[model samples]
Target chain A: MTVPVPFLLGAAALTLSTAMQSPARAQSAPAPQIALSCAGCHGVGGAGEGSVPRIAGYDRQAFVDNWSAFRANARPATIMNRIARGYTDAEVAQLATYFASLR
Target chain B: MTRLTRRAFGLSAASAGLAFAAPATLSAQTQARLVIIGGGFGGASAARYARIAFPNVAVTLIEPKTSFVTCPYGNLLLAGERTLPQITHSYDGLKARGVNVVHDWADGIDATAKTVRLRGRATVAYDKLILSPGIAIRWNAIEGYTEAAAEALPHAWIPGAGEQTTLLRRQLEALPDGGVVGFAIPPNPFRCPPGPYERISLVASYLKRHKPRAKILALDAKDAFSKQGLFQDAWNELYPGLIEWVPLNKDGKVTRVDAQAKIFETELGTRHRVDVGNVIPPQSAAKIAIDAGLTNETGWVPVNPRTFEATRARDIHVIGDANVGQVMPKSGYIANSTSKVAVAAAVAALEGRPAPEPTVYFNTCYSHVGPEYGISVVGVFRPSENGFVETPNSGGVSPRGPLAEQREQRRLEALHADAWYGAITRDAFS
Candidate 1:
């Protein structure tokens, strides 16, 4: 089984964002439970660590576009492609807004 | 961004503060009473999220235990990597967050009265009730296996720190070198599909160090299991010639056991005498769910995929292992995720607001094959007309491959698993 390169890149981006943000700003509202699930891989607040990317400050439009691409199979993905299909376009937008609201 | 209306503004204000003070506009409405039973991952999370999501609503968690010992990492205890204290969690953090933590058994649910009767306590009324009462062992599913038999053979399937788990560990320790250890794995749809295999791996890990000559025989009811390839690969690589798995086709299904003689008989009529026997009997929804008539003929509660409300009872939602027909596996992650969705719907109903739609659920199950070799499976699901379906291309098992990459990835996942344990436990209890 090969780990998807795009997934790793996405996680790396989250890690970069985590390093740039202040610890205080990282401590925000309690994430809705769905988003909180990401903490296992994306770090607390989606800060990202090591290979994971910083998703907390992602542009809402970018977030939506990425997930939409994954859902549509229009992007190179590993697990995200399958995960993205779990939500409707509206939920993707809501999640994007949720993550973007952090910073 | 949509402009915040008065109601949305009040909700935002209420969420911003830790105190359970409802906004003036929201306080005028009837006080909402949300009672959640069985303070496991699902119920505890529902209680905490309801407190934060709707401060005006009163959240009460009815659990018999003051502290919970999670099943997530209980295998580590068998390997002597972790102690009981490390996995125990207190409900004080939940109480501090304005949740009423009631220590009592929820004996029965009076759905008509919208109340839950407690053992030796007053009945608690609820506008919305969430039941996460995990699984109940089907005592007689395997002939000769009963509650009394567990004390001798010890299933250790349930999440009790000093009880079943400790008993199993003590049994393993007392076994002499070269003693045979046997496990009778249940059929499909059991809690934590990958769990028994993980336990087998950990037991092998322990025996490898303490009793290098000891052997493990796993008689499984199913032909395949979660992450089978991954687990088999790790067993071969790490503890070669130590573990043997017998599938159902080979008469792996255990029919009966003589606890006194320490012998297990399988469907093939082959009896195996072992020094230690770990029999994970068949399972169903907890007794409370069956008693309340929330469960179906399948012995699992059927629920609306969208709201997780019981099909038979209005205002009562079931999440966690008790709920069935969901695409998601019966694991802790799914329990936590479904709990949030249930809480969100319940709060919306209490406030007379439209429920949120297009909900997404996620689950990632990490199994430690050894101290450093971990594997995982991920799934993302959405409600469909029939039931919940996995989002295509979203979830899959951990990658298998070149030894170097596999080893590194497994090590990283082991670390991630620990982090996940902390994050999820905190999410539920703290």
Candidate 2:
């Protein structure tokens, strides 16, 4: 179609955005591989150290469910209840696996 | 063989030439130029649909960001489930689909001149303008927390606005055993209905593994949250000691936050200092909405629910978090869904056809409590006597009880969420 130049450009810009967004085919670290700073409180084994509960051996389903609950405000664990609400479902899964794998 | 192929190519070329020259032969009698401000879910979708429905239409999308980073899934990044790049998408795909994406900030809309002024001397004229610039921070809403203070105690309200998530994540990592992370939940009408609680879950999930001793303090303005019963059960069953939720009636309202000092003040003036603070301030429509006279006394655009056309302005449609659609939560899913309906109506109006009747839109907001555990609310909505009303018995919050099917449904919904994001982005840009 002989579209107007501006509209055509607009369409192209959006297409470019989509092209830039498609997930990468090359598999890499799915989550941020920053220094394992969590060891201080969590311990190296992913076991619960103190007030924090044991996250390593927990059920992945339970972890995901809990995070989802926090986001939905379905669950209430003061700071955790609030903190859990901040992550997307995907992030919750990534974290669940990350902590789960530490076991 | 060569002669036949050449002849066929020549015939196709001539037909294409005819098509290019015949704008009048298409649907629109008067070729109109549409300038769209912002390339978010609402603006991008409107641009694509407008171009498709009206072949003679000229569309331009002005947005400064090179990439459209979605806020819907950004929470995943905080929980350390997904990286920022996983949720980030560029405008390249939209560009390929024949959208003129202007990589510039929209300074002002010359409604009288029928032109949009850009930051640098650039300008674009339009017949119909669509502004879906999204919500801006009301920094003055909270005391002691200004734009600069946000650096230390990031609200992370605006997607990619600052480094609140990163800062909070980093601080959470560094916190000693028993460190407290305080989150001040804002009043209703914020962007996401269950967002504050979701953040709490992700943070708690992180702390449950790392700093088990650390606690999450959720100070709320509301008496209850979106899915209180389910979250409470999950927390108690999973990380009982790691979390404690304080509601407004129970002295949970936070009045002030000293960002530099890392202190939070309750309504009764009870001070609870913390290591990390996430204060989501009260919000309204972005400044441009107010400047354009599109917002009402409540500082949000009041639009015709069916079309999303601004009630105050002529031929201008406002969608996304900036608009006040009471029936719908100001979530990204709703914004994306409403944009489609608005686009259909806008297209019908241009073609001199009656707008579609009884538009029913769907919205599903999924949140991750830890990882595999997920909960969601799916609502199907249609226009009612007063405004948009949820379809009866079609959708509700995930059940509070225990079952494999419920969690499995949530897991599938997680994958479905990715596909939905992909599809919506495709519809908007591609």
Candidate 3:
């Protein structure tokens, strides 16, 4: 069981690394430079300010996982909930990973 | 400085005309030659997507400036929360994504030749032309204000490489402790619905901190604003003495601006003088759209809502603020979403595939009442047999109750506004 746990953890790490390196499948291209606009209010580290929560510290997989939920009306807010609906599944993930890396 | 002579102007015009006449002959049809006119949200998105969806496509986006400073977050900058550089974007990312980015003004489009002429001696032909040239300031609409006179009293409307945003910012900063700021809000069907209101709130926030006694007098052309009730409550609670809401009928209509005297005249012959003036004048589709025979009497391009292809021009599509799109605000989100549908329709037409039907779209306008508190409206839309219609009773405006948590939620959303701006710009240009 101990041996299996080590192997499983190593595989998970490999998977995470691969996902981060690969270009988002939905985008068909690398993400552009405009992502910097998010850094100010959201924090360069994603440690959000005032009412904005800590998106930077969110789990990478969880961040990617929540985007579809955000887009499909599962999540609701004055802005984010509506904004989340705009991106493709891949954009959600790309953004998710970028912010999660700051964590 | 070089003076504009008749002979020089004529030569420049003739050369530009010839540039439009030149035809671009690519080897393959699948290898599309795409020329996008504007560098705003629509044009930038089209250029980015064209490179991806059709890798073989030769994508060329033409704009006069190398950098694109967005009007979306410019209000925050005016509020002193953000800087000009924070909202600015460069074309380098688009160029890196396999796009031919050209820093030249689009003079005119030769539909017959399928080419666009530049102001200089250059032309680019295209298999499919996407024009998202944004809006133009309607100078003649206001009585005493012209393009030149706007220097003293800045509109700060246009996005990039100009004095508009910076000029307005400096004026706001320079204003006396108890001075008044007059915002001449434009009529409906403008670029950003919540924009003028947001501007008012932002300036009010600045006054609340620095001047405290300064006031924001909003002279709107419309009876109601984007998020009127929510904004009014926020203003009263946050900065009671700092902001004043005046509707069009309540002696708020601005007839003209005397820049020298800093006086704004109303319809009823009332003159209100202000120290800092930020007048968002009436607007129309950019001059490029009108010149291409795409505009109707409204000075905006009428397009098939299903495909965003121009009704008046063949093989040309117009999106963004320049195109007349009902059921969607001319917000960046809608423009970005509409561009996707337009791209898919164009690709399907080119590939002989059935264009997707019932294209659903959405728009969310987030306006910050202060730093942390924000309010917004979310509208979902789908193409109906008649036209694009909002999903009936599907989404509602921001909550009315003055709960502390709700205001905090508004603040979180405002922060998300910056996040989303980053994401959308990345999606479009990066």
CA lDDT, every prediction? 0.80, 0.67, 0.71
Per-residue lDDT tens digits of candidate 1, residues B1-430? 1111212222233332323333333222234578999898999888877765555567899999989999988999988888999989999999998899999999999987788999976899877899999999999789989999999889888875459998999999999999999999999889999999999999999999999999999999999999998899889888999999999999899999998998989997999999999998899999999999999988999998988999999889999999985568999889888898888886665444445665777798988878777888888888887579887756788777744757777887787677678777877887
lDDT agreement of model 3 with the native: 0.71
List model 2 lDDT by residue over A1-103, tens digit each.
Answer: 2233223333332333334333542112221211122222233334554343566666778888887776566874323443344344565666677666544
lDDT of 3 by residue, A65-99 (tens): 67666656676645555546555556456667666
The residue-by-residue lDDT of candidate 3 on B94-195, one tens digit each, is: 999878889998999988777899999788877668889999999958788788768888998886674798889999899998889988887888889888
Clashes of 3: 3
Q: What's model 1's TM-score?
A: 0.85
In candidate 1 chain B, where is summed lDDT lowest over 10 consecutive residues? Answer: B1-10
Per-prediction DockQ comes to 0.13, 0.02, 0.06
Where model 2 places Cα greater than 4 Å from the true spot, the runs are: A1-103, B1-30, B403-406
Better of 2 and 3 by lDDT: 3
- Candidate 1: Cα lDDT at B193: 90
lDDT, residue B12, candidate 3:
23
Better of 1 and 2 by DockQ: 1
What is the full ranking by lDDT, best candidate first? 1, 3, 2
Model 2, TM vs. native: 0.74
lDDT of 2 by residue, B348-371 (tens): 454334566546555667777766
